[model samples]
Target chain A: MEESLDSYVDKGLVKTYLFTAVIWLCIATTVGFLLSVKFWWPAFLSNIPYLAFPRLQMVHVNGVAFAWLFTAFFGVSYYYVPRLTRQKLFWVKGAWLLYFLWNFIVVAAVIEFLLGNNKGLPYAEIPIWINYIVVVAVVIYAINIFGTIFTRQENQLYVSLWYLMAAIVWSALNYIIGNWIPYYWATGNEGAMLNGFYFHNVVGMMVTPLGLAIAYYVLPIGTDRPIYSHKLSLIGFFALAFIYPFTGAHHYIYSPIPVWVQTIAIVTSVLLIIPVWVVITNFFGTMKGKWTKLTESIPVKFVILGSVFYLLTCFQGPMQSLRSMQKIIHFTDWVVGHAHMALYGAFSLFIFAAIYLMWPIISGKEMDKKLGNWHFWLGFVGFSIMAMVLWAAGLIQGILWIAQVPFLNTVWDIQPYWVIRTVAGAMMVLSFFVLLYNMWKTNKEAASMD
Target chain B: MKRSGNVILIAGFGFFLLGFVVVGLIPWLQPKQSTHTIVNLKGKPEPVNEITGAAAKGRLVYIHEGCWVCHSQFVRPVSGEKQYYGPVAQAGTYNYQLPMLMGKRRIGPDLSDEGGKHTNDWQFAHLYDPNSISPGTIMQPYPWLFHGSSAKPTKRAVELVAYLQTLGTDVAEGTGYKSYWQYKAAQVSAVSTVVSNTPQAVREGMKIYNANCQGCHGIKGGGNGPAAASLKPAPWNFTSGKWMSKYGTTDKDIYNRIAQGVPHTSMPEWATTLKPNQIWEVLYYIKTFSQKKTA
Candidate 1:
């Protein structure tokens, strides 16, 4: 079969990370579902302070960004690096050691947040000490991956490796800027400005590069063609690195942050459409004569589905950064919908495709195709319904607010939409459960065979 | 040499540093706005805006409880927020905070100028059980912030409330409307022009009563509304004539109580929610519950 794919790979380590990622995804989505439900049923778990909305919110955001996506990226990176480099993974033992140590830190950070010992900033809510442990873990991971690249038998670095290296560097820097900088340096609105930078970077640096890595690698292979344009890929990668950092303050537009800085953020945000479309164009170009693969391959369908949402969300992001649009939607559920669309709708879908591709290779067993399709439609339809309701509800709320009506009335008016949001959230959660079932069954069969 | 890897690595890192300086570093270098001193509801200046004492402890409790998550602190100039929340907050108003807690969502109302909007008694009751006063409120009952089964303040709750009370007072606003309302009510409070005890007048009073007072004071003036348990000293039930007279409940006294709110009870000030005539009408409706010849 082609060239034996796994002689140098640590399949067991990849399997462990993938399974861990799915469990954390389940936990995080459940937290998000409860958050939506709590809008109407505030007292459902009111007796427990840890289950309070804010505490649970801390659990939700961090669980997705750190616990879920971070681990999934680890799984994919472990699986992809050796294949791309044509080398055995460097410091395989160290990767396993970091796994348990890193997960322990994540769990401890979550518990500490629930215990009311939190940093109280967006995308950086974990307490400061936990931040140090996280950075050290990343350092070890970087060294291991970099070592593999250094000792590679393949002289030509793949497109995925370019992204892999950038993501490692960007994430380490972005993480420090978000969690650590404020403790020593900034205050008041300055801190908030830094937060806007950190907020976008977590997704921009953490998810975007890694997700596109998987997408770029998987798309051409699934389509049985080379990428559409090498020049386009190069343009997209460098433009993204250059533009993403300047765009975060768009989230905090109209705040106490300086107007010029906000403008800079807005301009850079709109400029992002270039790189975003370039990446999409390259992927679509790769998919040029392989339309039939949509029916033949589940991973191709998911990657394509994720690309559409990625385009919509990235476009929506820049439009929102425009101050006029923000005057209506800022602080509303519209932003919430936009955020969920990016992470859940776009990036998670890309990662799901990777997991689908990787599970069989790593485990030597296949997940049920019917269940995979079920997961796809449920996740796609459920998230679309949820995002639309949040966006519409947010628009209505924003209109009511601008009309100068009572604030409580807006909260009341949106209760019905929240019901829809909760139900759609339930569907998405169920989709993940279907995935969990398929992966678990594969694990069982793989174990029995061994 | 892997020239491509070095280009991506060095340039990617270069972009990261570029962003760090422009977005992160430059903003902190801007001269910070001044620290704002709070003026209490009595129109007295508080000890400079360092936020020490109970209020300072309350600030920590605010963050700890994640109150800042739902309750935003700054008010914007657009969208009638100034009309609604009293003032558009400047950056200096939050100068006391190391990193300001200008939260994103306003699931609750903005607390920009929230000081002295309601009394400590109302704040205590609302914090223990928000639905007690605003039947449709989305706020979760923070009973843990209180004592066992009562609205009595634990140190944290008291500090939290203290911090809340100081919210928008930093900018020398509020009490303008309160004093104006008080003066207007005092002018015509002696006579019951709007509270005629007629069939139509009583019906009008019933409407206002149902809208506002009926939640806490009960449908039959029995102080046994659905939310009555969480309040200390409880809401008043006027079914018994004795309790009505205990407060020297003349027409003027009744108007003053409605406008200023009662102490040690769940009754919030109607200065903002009701007009003077509406309060007088609701007063006449409640008087009918008095089992006395003079009701």
Candidate 2:
């Protein structure tokens, strides 16, 4: 009876994580729709100070990247880390405190940004004070995760542990370096270039690694296959860890930086294809005989599709980093398209898959799998349409811009594309509603399971 | 199995730490060279005149406005940009630029050679209201440049205009417009008869024209301007015969453009920025220069 009750308690923890994931995902998607509209119609929320594109863009990015993805990661880690280690969580209270702190930090940062106190870098828009809160939250998480690992009943650590452990440690270091707080405060206004440098690394070290780590864990587990080769996994991880930090300079290629710095960045960006290809080949190899499983399982479908997008986005990222390509694409909608594909198509889908896979184990019963299927298909179609439209629009914009066509020519050229983006964005909004409905249904079924 | 796993984990961590140290220190220890010496990439670089005291003062205002965020003073060797924006900007061009404003991002065009691009009147009008002339320009309006006096030119706007007119003056050295300001003042005084109908009407017209026409037509009525450098199928040189003949100098045509604006050009409708009567006055002012032989 005690063992049975402990199993139920474990399920309750999973429920908490899943609920948080779904909530943040809906919030992020809704904000994403608002941002999409702002691109075509700047006047949509022109009268409202907080709703302007600059402010809304920062909010949308933080919502999707940090709020939704981090919460979902927390949910997955809580369920899988202890289960894989054959141990109870080292500190449930610490985990709960970390969650609250994370949410509070995000809320405060968004409020400060809306009120016009931002660091003014893309993705690193949150203020200095909010960075402190985030660091504290990460520290708490690191202690809890590490403590659980140290106290595990299982003697042999799993592959998931490797990815998860590295993600936490690296992300913590990334936050410190990316913020460059002491250096920035010391240099004052002259630190803008340095700040840009740090900002690039934040995307490199924090977002990319965390997203890939989650994918590494979820893909193998959902496919019911061990990763195809441990050697390949090690190779991918090490190559990524080594190369990603330096590649941030690619964003600054055309700027007034020293030439060698830009050259170093371009080389590393190209070489990054090695790690990406390794991961892609390994995932495809593992899923080789499991094509039918994708059709049957909503979680597998989202994860596999996400992996495919990850491959496309990383490839395009290196191409865009090329000086000639950047000449046409930088400051245009092409970068926007790349950003959406990376953040929404790749990371968001993987987060959704991880939550779906963990929900039943946490709820101690099966959810209405039919609703999950509906959610998956809606998101899959919506994200694909949105990505394709943006890519089309971006290409049109790039060609016209580089051709030395009149400025008005490029603006007129992209009008039809903007209309398509709006339509695609509407479909994505509908997908969010479907996701909300599915999660709510799952919650109701979990209550009934008791 | 557990013992072997422990050994592997310890070894892995050590290898990772060693890799991190090596990668992090490598760049710092062997830093990239600080500078490069390029050969006469564009032939002997154009001769630069000594920076004037006033131009030096104007450079401060440029930096304060964060103008470097969008406007690149330096043009690259790339064919599309070079052909469109004039000759590629050389390193010698920036010899006198303190904390050089050679920016990234071409939201507007490079201003490497903006001297004698337009008349002082055009510059004044543009600085007052960009939509008044250029219409549909992305440049943020400089309302702060003018004193809030009822539509009259302020001293500050004139100084800023003085600064813009000086860009790319090296090419204009031997021409009658050797000094951009002296040429602009002479042009404004010479064309006083065409615009003498009403100072108030012309002032309102100037406001409308600046906001609408100044980006492509220039701050002055001269054809060359900052934004013109970036435009492909470049903006028409307003002082040229081809421009006047192509767009007729009739009152109706000028009024129609100012009131309704040209479709598919950066020119936007001035109906929002100007009153109907004000738009007519601006048309009258534009027609004054339409019949002129020189800028």
Candidate 3:
């Protein structure tokens, strides 16, 4: 069994995943800073084509969403899946090929977008050829994950395993439906509706589920306690499976989509409150009387804070989906704030926690708690400041626009808000450095343990 | 150990299930009804033809491009709007719209009555290269709409024009169609006449001014319109000497300034927004501003 578990932990795969995560984290954070500066001082990079606001925005979003988060996800999954299942990966070669292919697709997509060959949908702006590459990579991922599960020695699946399996399967299915090839490239004129469907589902099915799966696995393990309620976990999982697909329309509340579609979206979004709150309450309740433990364990701190962000983001998401609320917030920086809170605050933090918790076991070493603490504090403080500033900017912009105060007057009013966002974004950049430092230190310690 | 973990897991799953029902399933099953009513204010009942019409097809293009994110088609009933945009939009104006474009943002102005507001040449120029006709416009030029060629009008431009010309006018009242034809005829007449003995300085200034200022100031220096309307601080009526006085009175002052530009206002610097001789022509035109008469 010891030999088997040892075989399950591949140092090379873990290193590859970690290196990608660190590299992409730096790239994404830098681009994020550049995007914020562009907003604050448009003249700074106004002459450059690739650095223009629109192109920079695409780079920033894709870097964070695809490169940073997915890299982290790959790293964590590579480390934990084998340890949790008590078996070696189905195919190490297959997984390594997936890593290379995934990166290749991301790099090509970024270049295509910079060259102005975009499909023009938010989040789906990558060119069609690049999208096909992503589809190929996803298929490879699905096959590898399923093969690993089928070959596992464990008979009774753990809740973590269930979540991991469900996330992969569901994401694979949703991606195909969301990015329906015929609709996206064929009828370019009506592609917006199809793109909107695909774009929101990417958030709902891909980002949300994957993040939650990692959180569920890491939180219980890091706390040295079993989950508070298995019933609640199942509820959250099934509820997400049933409801997330329809909620994509919420993004179109004031849009030109049919009224019935928006109605479906608003109701689903509001109802999402139940699943989101349930998950929050259950996770926190399990941590009941164990607050001190959280403080002691850096991984616990990251996981708990991530869960808190999840609660905050989902609640804000539902509120923003309401037609009346959308009237005040749609197409404004408010949605940008919401995306950051959901994707970065909740998802990325959870992924980070999963990495920290799993790294010691996978690499056969103990991480320096001091470095972990530094990383956690930086990320927590940085994310909090960034989220707040973005939310404030979005809200102010939304209210002023709706008030019809006057076009030129509104632009003048929001100049200070944009400046504040840039300042807040600086904190996030600092946090990324701290994260890299901690991860690098931990890696060295793990090597020493070997 | 296995038994305990299993029990704990089961309990966790159960709580999640309950939460799902309360939050996810319940919301999905519930009926969502909205109280707000959208009014289409262009003064005509939406024709069945408009519902299944070429305008609807153009609207699909609008959606595909995410145009609604920046440009609202609806004009709200507000004091600033009433004063600036002619009339507030009504619910009837949207009766023909299948999916209404009452967009939520004011990145650009409300475009409810953009029809009959400008000449076809002006619209074509703006669409082909927004910076070519209106220098400070933040709106991305729709080069694709002009077939991705060198800023020439295309069939898509014509179709888009047809859609814009339908905005804000009551076609049922017959005035919308009449005004559209009248505007088209005037554009033809204006294009035919070449001003005789026009100084090179004046000609350059006119080109600069038209490319950078025409959207808001009107092609003829009259403060008429652009497709965007929801400007909170309304666009300046350039025809007024009072407005011109806000800049400066002297011809040289106006020339140097127009060649440069006021900071922070939509007025971009001609060094960037226009060429040097173009700036001089724009300045020459501004010198023609008279306090005694409106354009």
lDDT leader = 1
Worst 10 residues of 3 chain A by lDDT: A182-191
TM (chain A) per model: 0.98, 0.92, 0.94
**Which is better, 1 or 3, measured by TM-score?**
1
For model 3, how does the per-residue alpha-carbon lDDT over A277-365 read when each residue is reduced to its tens digit? 88898899889888897868877888888898899999998888877777666656777778888888899889878777766665567
Error of 1 at A358 (Å): 1.0
After superposition, candidate 2 runs with Cα above 4 Å error = A1-14, A181-197, B1-295
* lDDT for A124 (candidate 3): 62
TM-score of chain B of each: 0.66, 0.47, 0.48
- Of the candidates shown, which would achieve the greatest DockQ relative to the real structure? 1
List lDDT for all candidates, in order.
0.80, 0.62, 0.63
Model 2 TM-score? 0.70
What's the DockQ for every one of the candidates?
0.42, 0.09, 0.08
Native contacts recovered, each model: 0.50, 0.04, 0.04
Task: Give the better candidate number (1 or 2) by lDDT.
Answer: 1
Model 2 lDDT tens row, B122-228: 55555555444445544434555566521455565665566776786665455444533233323221111233357677776666556556666776666555555
Interface RMSD of 1: 2.5
Q: Model 3 residue A369 lDDT? A: 78
